[model samples]
Target: MVDSVVLVGCGNMGFAMLKGWLDAGMLQPGQVHVVEPTDALRERAATLGVNAVAGAAQLAAGLQPRVILVAVKPQVMGDVLPAYRRFAEHATFVSVAAGITVNFFEKHLGDKTAIIRTIPNTPAAIGKGMIVTFRNPHVGDSDAAFVDRLLKTSGAVASVDDESLIDAVTAVSGSGPAYVFHFIEGLTEAGVAAGLTRDIAGLLAMQTVYGAGALAAASADTPTTLREQVTSPNGTTAAALKVLMGGDRLKNLLTEAVHAAHQRAIELGKV
Candidate 1:
């Protein structure tokens, strides 16, 4: 049972996960503790009825959390994490800070400590995020399952067997949201160019993307099949495909972008 969870940062993503757990009844306010130095963020956590402190020193005495979630910035982790060493012997450390590796946490906490690393996207703020996690071998199945259940409250959860795949996951799911956002921007611009009002264009673009994503997710058919289904011979979609699919323009561009993101993730890990 995850009786107590300590979240070290209360930023947007961290706060979203906390809200999901509370709203889903996966966690009780009294069982949650937040450590954030920022006054505004601390007050925000307090508004949720959880204990909020400026630092680990203020955590209740003799209270070892079941999970210690590190959500701080990657650069500050080196300075912020050492204070939680007392819990290293007992708690499972979970980090959502991108670019920081399991090795970093293990080194700070203890080699024997169980660490779980996750990369989650911004959509999680709306309970539609996709999160990919990797558990250190020291972590057992039960602990991993508990973490998975907790994460599911926010969105989808997938376990990665190999830690190396986490960088790829970061590139695909973590950075992928920005790509989709840019697509929406482009679509909205195209709609406006086609003589629609700006507001109407924005609405249509957003809804179209949302519907398409939902349909793709709900169907078992491959995206290629779905695209083909939409492209009747000599149809508008076919005309559009002539520009996008011609020479695999969209495919190659996306591949290049994801590869660049993956390389950046690797560099961040080293930092």
Candidate 2:
């Protein structure tokens, strides 16, 4: 029963989700309202035919959106939440600002407000991202389901009842795209070192990662089985894997990286 939505802050991530919803036809432009302080950003949203305003005070009088999604930076959220507190009684408050928890929203928006905290990555701009959410107890099943439908327009959506798992989500999918991008950069450098032209090397590295990820997603076989299928004994792929996986080198490094990110997420939540 989500009839309309109010999206506060239309920066990169916010704009991406906004476009996703409109492009998917899940919600009409008239049904969406955007509040962005930046002129260029607000104009960008206006071009999409949605109502775009500079602040909450400019929002249509008597507005009661089903969900008010706050996408501003975590640092500024304290100043932003108070203006929208009036909507807490009816509208579900959804925050995409990292490290801001459900309890923080309740403290600002009232304890009775339904709040959803989510971590979404940059890939969502292209409609290919992973978004994970954790909802406060006040959120009803229908409201949760409606939010899921809205989030799905951007990418795959998953939820967890245990709010603590959100930090793990931040470490994993929320920050994972950068890891994959870095790996592509390294692979491209290696290709250039092996005597390939820089352009050719970059293209190969990018396509290989893209193709492999697509295959992994489409195939019924497990990734381990797929890797084994491509790697023959004493072959080139095997040799490469030996250097990468010897003594679990790559695995250990990734585990350490994820752990560091997880710890940082926990620390941020405390702030």
Candidate 3:
């Protein structure tokens, strides 16, 4: 269990993580501190009984948190990160800001600061997200495990030894949700174009996507096996599979798309 934690932002993702932590009993409300400049957001955080303040300046004097989560946007991270530098001597820092590198955190906090850079999709809001972490050498084994459990409050967590792989993680999971959403949208539109009512098409599209994901997650069989199970020679599923996998067109397109996102993530992390 975490003794004390400081959350630096409480926007959509941040707030969701905080709520998950509280709900999971990771820390007591009294043991958590939230720094949110916006009045409404701070109040929302306070509603959870945590010590919510407008800024780091308002934190109780001499209070040092054991774990500090930096959830602010990358664009504003420069302005917000310095406030927590005082805790560099003690706290283990975790960042969920996309495109921000571990080196970037070292530059802002301290070269030896124990930092973990993680990418969590928006699904984390619902406790089903995928989070991939890469920790700096300064982080101890115990603290690294602590981070893994802390993130699990929001969803599943994995780790990568090589920091550079984080860029690929960003492309595959960080930006992958939008791709799924777009597929659902396209499926719904296609249904409508095929003469299904808009309402029915939307429901079918949503439920099919949700069910498929849930089944894939719960089943031990590989997705390839699942696909084969649903497909038969000259069947409708086979026809669709042919359109999607024929000459590996869809596979090539998806590979290119992930590559594009990976490259962009790398570019965004530039110092």
Best by lDDT: 2
Ranking by lDDT: 2, 3, 1
Go through the candidates in order and give each one's C-alpha lDDT: 0.91, 0.94, 0.93
Instruction: List, residue by residue over 1-271, the lDDT tens digit for candidate 3.
Output: 4478999999999999999999999878999999999999999999999999999988888887888999998999989989888999889999999888888899999999999999999899999899999999999998888778889998889999998999999999999999999999999999999999999999999999999999999999999999999999999999998999999999999999999999998887785
Candidate 1: misplaced stretches above 4 Å?
none
lDDT of 2 by residue, 1-271 (tens): 5499999999998999999899999899999999999999999999999999999999988889999999999999999999999899999889998999899999998999999999888888889989999998888889899899889998899988899999999999999999999999999999999999999999999999999999999999999999999999999999999999999999999999999999999998887
What ordering of candidates by TM-score runs from best to worst?
Answer: 2, 3, 1
**lDDT, model 3, position 9:** 94
Q: How many Å off is the CA of 252 in candidate 1?
A: 0.9
Query: In the order shown, what is each candidate's alpha-carbon RMSD?
Result: 1.4, 1.1, 1.3
The true-versus-predicted C-alpha distance at residue 215 of model 3, in Å, is: 0.3
The local lDDT score (0 to 100) that residue 77 gets in candidate 3 is 91
Task: Supply candidate 1's per-residue lDDT for 257.
Answer: 98
